[model samples]
Target: MSSSSSAMLHTSPLRRYALLASNPPASTSYSTRAMAIELATLPLPASADASKFADFGREVKGVNLGSLTEEQLKEIQELLYKHDVLLFRDADVTPEQQFALTKAFDPTSAVYGHGNNKTGKTTLSILHPDLKTIPRVPQVQLIGNGMVYNHEGLAEAKLKHPHHKTFHKTHISDEDEEKGATRFYRWHIDAALYDLSPPKVTTLYGLSVPRGGKQVCRYDDGTGDELEVPLGTTAFVSGRTMFEILPPELKSLAVRSKVRYAPHPYVWMAPAHAKSTGLGIENEGLEMSFDDLPPWEQSKVKTFPILWKNPVTGGLHFQVHPCGVSELIVDPLPADAKKTGNELYPDGAHIKDLGAVRDILYKMQRPAIAPNLVYPHDWHEKDMVLFHNRGVLHTVVGAFKEDQVRAFHQCNLAASDDPIGPSEEDIKKWA
Candidate 1:
């Protein structure tokens, strides 16, 4: 974080010693990294339809979303609201198209997300499976962003993966260290650190997801099933497609292993963070155990997980990533209540006992469902799809990584005629 930004944030009301002694609101807002981890399937919107567009998987390359006619643009926007995501394969896009796509979704969003220093417009990453961008600097590419995984300009506490790669944990990497072809970023939400509404829809056009069989996974909640939608398919998520209602079994399995018992120092950061941001985000989220929660807390746990609705269409979407959630304290149930456990997906995920808890667990799993409707297209290299930012969630099966030479571009801009960012009122309603 810049000294100026830090000064602004800290100097704000949350810093008073008394407020700091207890819990504060700014901590609720600014405490964690970019994305909240230890996740449950976040929910989708209310108006979901899976089969609206038969041309969804069609692929086309080398063009700008800017070229579409005014009528076509309106149709695309409406389609996005109806289907969540629109897929155009083999898309060849220009910087202008990149900017236009941003405008289509959230005109208020920056044309160049977080600039080169933070979010990569044509960014780069090096996973062994795919090569996505030119020169291996991936901000140059855009992929299925059901959930925004990029942070804002630059914030010290932006929530991100423990490591850019699967196995490493040093929070600080200076620019000199990351100047090479391999650029790594954690899975997180766009504009999550500050009080910014997450970009409703993010796009990732795969130049090549490769046939090597290294399938990167995305969490599909409805059936608690893993969906391997092909590269050509743009996973549109909106109302009714929320991940909040995950499968009963899958929700428990994600954290059931040793991950459940591990004690992380970051857990200690909660009191400090929560004390500052009355937003109530506990820094010690992962440490709380299902068995240790208080009665009211347990009830909240028993209730459905947090889900988001697009303020624009009143549509729902599943926006949770497995690694981005926290555990809530739960209270033990009465003996009789415990006897009536859930009877679905009775896999290893559910033990012999804890039946009631199991029921609550089941409720936490958002059903893995597709957009009520989608604009299906054939996979081709000359096309690009655009949609409403506050409309749906999007995802894909291929890694589309920079190593594979996969290329795509994106730029965010305000859609309003007056040209102002998304209003804070809308962000509150949407996020």
Candidate 2:
């Protein structure tokens, strides 16, 4: 693992935390609600080989997710902000209830992150083939593989789990695939990356999970790095860790850089193919032409910071969607900067060449996705997972057979506000 300086770790006064349930429902006030439930830290997934990510998720038990009160919702939102992921086992949450829990994080926001239920209609979108929205609660989408019948008002629907074979430039042979081999199906933060702000958090409830032997996820980048992952798993890596693991020069560049996304991003990248590792697109010049995209406006295009500040922890997280990014605009070193020598961008530079931009980001971000740092959640029936969208990068791992039916409800709202970037102190300290 790469070493991080003491500056990256936020120092705080320690406080006691425990597993507790409110016997006589706590008051609605923030102070009283704080006592309602304390988030209980849990062990990482059984397959995880390291303890570095123990703070990534907290397990909540004995709570009825379908009927959470305002106070409970606020506490969960706070916990989600601090831990970045929460696990609820054996949950019986409905589509409406799942949407409610997601919206509780951003009260005024009501629409789904991807054009408010416009995925299918926008055939050019990269997300078109992955999600099927629930009819009653448009915010919640029904995802997974195979045919689902009479589910939440939809009479019949065929769901297809995204497979690396379709997106990756070079995939394993069918014989190898049949032998339980797979790849991560695009590492990403769930967002439209256009007009809509990135969602603050996402909730996924597993309805039917296909049970089978573990599969080997091959990076296929010639390093021969591979992971033994559960069938149809979702892999995650912390964005904060992605930022912290960077070398000093890269760290300085990350804090001072901003990423400009392509217009109608998903549609713009529809023709592109991803790398074998699913980190970013291969540079074969297959992206859609700007003129070919649907009617779009310059004002609607997004340009976000390379680093997003965590609201609760005040940590700066490296948050970039590798596939959708078009350019990198970096600021020069501050006049009063403390560090010197071999600086990346001493004078501000705007990188417009797609290849150069992707190469720079790939070198800085790929180390964090090493096997020891990844967390592949093992899904079980009725298991609900909520993750802080801006704080981590995740991907769907492995493919499912057509006959194996798997179903899940997913929800996330386009945030009402844009993510916060680094402060002046952070720039002066790092740059």
Candidate 3:
């Protein structure tokens, strides 16, 4: 980034975060709610009733990726876009094989959730864990204590961000809660920062999961655990509709407040120049502030961008996640707003009432329609589960935690923005 752009994005503490707290909604050809409903409520044909959720992929065969041509690889990318999620059943592939295969879909592949989610396919595969790197970010997210929001990815606040080079959680035996206790997430999305939606397909390979997995234990007696989600089955979540019912507090906050946080494509689209800069921030440094950007460049950023387009229809979807940096963290607000001429956000008194706002936002945790959809993949060896990242909010049940150790070599389907979000873009970069 230019010294100017860096300064422009620079948001030091003291600069109230409410400035960028909320970005206006994006203009999309398709309705986010409608798409959420369609995907979440799609009816399977009578044949589908007898057929398993992923029998389609099993029926359609593909040449072993190890034998595909570069052109064929590109074709597969397009194919993945079409199918959204595909499963590769019972094929002998190693983590290295999985990584290579995942990379085939996107050049920017990254292994995410270093320790929170299992990755190595088998007990032996655990030894072959993928590489880890500290995310360089300007903003810091600290929620309560165990729940911190940082670019290093989600973790219990007290835990040293598992990906941390030196920090590793002690895997306490179940009998010992205090000792081997690693943290658990309260069913949340991956990125909550910006308004950018996720991609169409994400694949998870179940290397191992507990036999008495938590995922499959939901009550069926009058309770709403309809889908008997199984391990090895790649489950999908609906990002936009997870909680379409915006809480009264949030609405009051939204309608009552004139001040708004514009979604910067930096969450998705950063300057092309940054990419060549070695994740950009590293060479130039993350201290780069948004104030450094020319007013004209600032004009180029999008408050909200349609992140997911239908692989087949090319339609857009809404994005809603508990993304941290992208949202205004009332406390420890960044200083970029005051230091600069409100490039990050316009000044407003609305922030004083954030606590009230939190109450309203808390209400959104429920569903206007469905709480959230989990399209479990039952991650068998060759199975691949894909879904629009923007379409849903997904979580790994970690059910395979039983004697059946489950995992596969994995990585974030990387993009070129955000030092910290959905990708290098959605993660932790600033405009």
Candidate 4:
């Protein structure tokens, strides 16, 4: 929002949540006067792995997400399905209260999962040069990085801010990126996979916060991994701790698989690239040729399900987004189950080989993006955050300074249902 941040939001006043009149500081915080909401977990990542994520994320103090109530929006959707990320530092939110707290976590949703000007008319989408539409809350998206003046209605924009040397595939030398070195610009899970649906939550907010100096993220995929982050940080990673640290035959190939995706999938992988550990595409066939994308519809493609469950921690998350996949299917092993060795496709298959579907989703989502199982987010000016778009797998890490302007205000919605897979006793207890 920038009309001098909407004129400093009328000289400050939206803080709310008083009545703590004493006694509330120990056992890692939490407060509730019928949801006056106070919470407090988010801190780990001094190279995290603190005994497996130490309860994902939380922070949220004195809640004024612009006056919530519906029992504080059902305890902020049960604290975002039990803390999959929620921070809110100094927030005063508004793009209509961050699209009504992201449509109150799917109250039958309302647009923008990639279709309100659809990444600005899909210029071969890879989110066409990173989002901007917020002309009075077009499901809130003003994103960050460069020029911005009247904002919210855009009378001058320019933004950008996504930089793994233009979608990665080996990059990290401009004297190791001017010595502050970075990477991780696209891990994903905001999902516009196809005919809209996957957005169970995602709020962001941080208006213009770009103070610099922390950079190092470089998992150049050779695994000398790196992580010191926080320059333009936003990292995160834990689809249920990437399905509880896999290896039960990749958690029974992630609850018996499903993926598919691809049609228009950001214009069929906007000419490929990723995977210097941004986790997915590096096949080099440089995509875009299902008869030249864009008019898709084998019944609007999609497919989904490599795990997902967790409606408040039934816990089975491994959610897949590996560069808009394109077929994996699987489904076999349950007869008496216990096969133990040589179990990969157990009997069923499908796959459609794009380097064997990015080598089985990079051997089951690369050890949950290790750098001690990441968290990264360090933004400040009125922060906000939220996340748990069906569990986690974020990205967009460091590098900014073409005069570093970085404003923020995101918000997610396109999900009037779809993402509840896995039960049949969670596929016979993980296939």
Candidate 5:
């Protein structure tokens, strides 16, 4: 027998078939046999259809981090990039496990401490006086209406700073301190005004969830109603979907423009006796002009693109925090212009129009409120949710009673440094 024929006769049936599949003989019948064998051996692709996953309040399932293998972890990572928000129902993960899962997705991200220094370790003892960090893990912030209260009732002893009053009063209703609405409720992405790059992923583990009356919300279609669900649910809007439906003119403007944000740390620096006020409403220090702010505060000004493209998913997202932005510069002139003394005007002067940028953002905000685009998560105890900050805008759904214990441990993944703008030409070409 020939050497090729001898080798084929000695090989296993599966191996022989696989080899033939790659190099089929001249006979059409052999080619057909090879194709059939090849098809039988190939692995199937994972499902990417969003509907197959859970929906709204309980979106996404089958995530058990405690028992996750390398392959399963990779699949979760892919789902996060694809779905933007994932609700791991009743995950019941411990602090260490949560930290490990976060590190897997972002190896370099440090557990974020609310008032930690630039390195995210050294504590700034003076900040967030009303909030307490978990002693075992300082990065986990204890947030809820009940944290400050005790058997003595609204334990004034725990509050040591003027801003503590602002924090304490925020969760209570103005009409009745005991039944007040949450003052911090506002649609926003975290840390937009800070000097560091904003966090890319945020995971919130619900340790305790309060069940109560329906939470009221206004819809984009000029309709308002109460959601027949538990209080303290976190509401989210898909920024990518919002950007996709924008008018072509606004879409182009967002890709080409940038927003200017200066430090407005009211949540971190509220005066000792200042009354708690809801975010997005008029509050102290929120209206100061850039020039009016102290030099140190003015130095916090950072410019960011209006439209940001996710590196992993290649998805385009509108990245404006309307409440956080101090100024909007549309079609801003280049920063490195060479001009004579008389020709050199201030950077603010070159802004095409002051309100123009905000007007365009408002257009985006309107569509974002539609029910189809928003997902309000009705959190269950031990439910861990991981969401991409680049693709979603989230806020507190409603107020929880002071007696209701609604605690959560929040961790953030490191921010991406890739320039934010329109999608890459290659990604666009494929689309």
Candidate 6:
């Protein structure tokens, strides 16, 4: 076994105990939902050696959309909440079938909508422009290297702006310049920049897997390097683990802190460059002063708790994403206060200190990248992985050649209005 793999195994026992202690089995009973056909959990393949965090995921071999029953649907829901991730090997599901599965999880999810297009009903298509949506089901967007190139267009579009042009030329590399254009490289919580609540769950069905060249990444601690055995893998970090590892003092502060996010138009815009630089559109960046933004744009600020309790698993998790957060205020007033701008920051208190707080959060997040906490899913055709957005942060691990057809269909469960803020009771218990 490789050193990284051995290190991961060494820490698995401790991490598993921590996870169990923090996330005790759910006491609430599930409804008597039954499946049409019994679905059985299958043993993982001997070669299947991903996911250092046991219980993070499970592989089930018994059912598909055609054979799905209400009971099986409920069981899948229960599994998703309990494990935070689920893997279905050889899941031969059609786009319509995928849509049906998403509906089973959350009927009102945004999986069926016109997305950004003004006219026809279109789901978000992350696949190559040529890959047409399934005849009647447009909700399933195909994803792969094409989506990555489309992201590059957005980055290049920013070059039209004088300030961005200078910054890119000075700080970004030819390689990074191309990659940064696509927001896929950035680690973030989904739908964080929008006014709407973020998604609760996300599902991905793999159609093609990259093979051959190894994907090498530096350790978060800058200790050395670790190789991603799978060429194109999807990496995930547990938000629960991130919260568990925080320094006691910082944990206390984080549980009480709130983060504010502004409107980020480029979140999923395809051909981003054209839309970003189009007439009447204004480019925005984190470095730009809040006061400089137009009143309407400035009004887009949305606040969320930094540390929140997951109602599903009854576990504490961090909801922070350094890239998406624009400001951090410790112990913010209730929403009724309607504070804005400078009023939001009293005495410029944590103004300069925000970076320090962010650095700590990043450090806490680093362990998730560690072999022990990280789960890099090696994709195989017909494989489907479902994960809870409320408990984990995920990103694409490696780059794929343009010719590689790494198609995937993604679906999301809409976030609930249930308060994310930790209660005094929660802080005492989880802290």
Q: Evaluated with lDDT, which candidate comes out highest? A: 2
lDDT of 6: 0.51
Q: Say which candidate scores most in TM-score.
A: 2
True-structure Cα RMSD, model 5: 14.8
- Which residue pairs does candidate 5 place in steric collision? 162-272, 172-180, 173-180, 173-181
TM-score to true structure, per model: 0.42, 0.90, 0.43, 0.32, 0.65, 0.66
lDDT of 5: 0.51
Error of 4 at 206 (Å): 0.8
In model 5, which regions exceed 4 Å deviation? 1-60, 111-131, 148-184, 219-229, 264-300, 332-357, 414-419, 424-431
Q: Could you tell me the C-alpha RMSD of candidate 6 in Å?
A: 14.3
TM-score (C-alpha, index-matched) for candidate 5: 0.65
**Comparing 4 and 6 on TM-score, the stronger one:** 6
Q: List candidate 6 stretches off by more than 4 Å.
A: 1-52, 111-138, 146-184, 219-221, 265-300, 332-357, 416-419
lDDT of each: 0.32, 0.84, 0.31, 0.79, 0.51, 0.51
Report the C-alpha displacement of residue 24, candidate 4, in angstroms: 14
Worst 10 residues of 5 by lDDT: 35-44
Q: Which sections of candidate 4 miss by over 4 Å? A: 1-63, 66-70, 73-75, 82-169, 172-183, 186-205, 209-252, 256-274, 280-309, 313-315, 319-383, 405-424
Off by over 4 Å in 1: 1-64, 89-92, 111-116, 120-193, 208-239, 243-307, 318-322, 325-366, 369-380, 387-403, 410-431
Clashing pairs in 6: 34-71, 35-71, 35-72, 127-142, 154-273
Q: Which clashing pairs does model 2 show?
A: none
lDDT of 2 by residue, 373-430 (tens): 8888889999999999999999999989999999999999999989999999989877
Query: How far in Å is the alpha carbon of 335 misplaced in model 5?
Result: 20
Off by over 4 Å in 3: 1-60, 70-72, 108-201, 209-227, 231-234, 240-312, 323-365, 368-372, 386-391, 398-404, 417-431
Q: Which ten residues in a row have the lowest lDDT in candidate 6?
A: 273-282
